[model samples]
Target: MYKILAVDDEIEILKVIDEFLTQAGFMVKIAQDAEAGLEILAKEKPDLLILDMRMPGIGGEGLLRELSRKKIDIPAIILTGYARTDAGLGFVKKDSLKILVKPVNLSILLETVNECLRGKRDGQTKDPDC
Candidate 1:
């Protein structure tokens, strides 16, 4: 089973994601903040990361930057209230990174997860099915 790490400040969101992904047969881990997420990253080394872009401290963007600085490469999906055209996401350089806005549908989330992981399996930036 693929290991997935989801980091969000909202406890409810984390719970929902954990339950959903777990039910989908993934080994899911949750972190309530970027700091905790970092610790989990070091220990768990998950295959994928589901990240909330906005948080109290060192939010999603910061975590991504830190990962880059550390030369850690992993597939990621970004959740944010911002739109696709949002200026806040300009710093993100990975072409394969998927950005899903808040109020994302569960089915779409599942589809994205499959596609992203499939790409990882195939050693590509994204699945051709995307």
Candidate 2:
């Protein structure tokens, strides 16, 4: 099973994702914030990351930039309740970054995760072209 790390400040959001992804046959890890998420990234090297753009400590954009700087190329999907403009859409404009607006559809999220994993397996060097 693929390993996925979900980082969100909201406990309910993290719990929901952990439960849903677990039911989908993934090994899901939950991080309360970006700092914990980065720690998990270093130790777990998860196949995918699900992030929330807004959080108390280091936000999702900062985390993404840090990961890129560290050359950690794991695929990430950003979920946020904030408007795209307010959240600074530029950080996630990269092809590899998938942004899901809040109240995300679980089915869509699952499908996106599967697609990303498949792309990784097929040796697709670039991020999702969509």
Candidate 3:
């Protein structure tokens, strides 16, 4: 099973993601904030990261920037209700995948997650729909 690390400040959101991914046959890990997410990233090396764009400290963008600095190429799906604002742009890079708004559609999220994992397995560098 593909491992996933999902980070969000809201425990409810993390819980929702955990339940959904687990039902989809993934090994799911949850982090309540970015720092915890990073720690988990270093240790777990999940195949994918589902991150909330806004958090109390070192938000999703910060984590992704750190990942880039570390040369880690983990696939990611960023959730933001911000509508592509400048704050949300901090994490955009060549490998940008899906950026879902808050209250994400479960089916779309699932499709994107599956696509990301499949691309990883197929040796694709970027998600075509991005």
Query: What TM-score, over all chains together, does every model reach?
Result: 0.88, 0.88, 0.88
Total clashes in model 1, counting residue pairs 3 or more apart in sequence or in different chains: 0
Q: How close is candidate 3 to the true structure, as a TM-score?
A: 0.88
Clashes of each: 0, 0, 0
Against the hidden true structure, what lDDT does model 2 obtain?
Answer: 0.83
Candidate 1 ranges beyond 4 A from true positions: 85-91, 123-130
Top lDDT model: 1
The runs of at least 3 residues in candidate 3 whose Cα sits more than 4 Å from the true structure, single-residue gaps closed, are 85-92, 123-130
Error of 3 at 43 (Å): 0.4
RMSD values for the candidates in order, in angstroms, are 2.2, 2.1, 2.0
Provide the overall lDDT of each model, using Cα atoms, as 2-decimal numbers.
0.85, 0.83, 0.83
Error of model 3, residue 91, in angstroms: 6.4
lDDT of 1 by residue, 1-130 (tens): 8899999999999999999999999999999999899999999999889999889899988888888789787778888887863366555555547878988898999989998899767887555443
RMSD (Cα, Å) of model 3: 2.0
* TM match of model 2 to true structure: 0.88
In candidate 3, which residue pairs get closer than 3 Å at backbone N, Cα or C atoms, i.e. clash? none
Cα lDDT tens digits, model 3, 15-119, are: 888999899899999998899999999999898889987898998878888898887877789888877834545545645556788889888989889887886
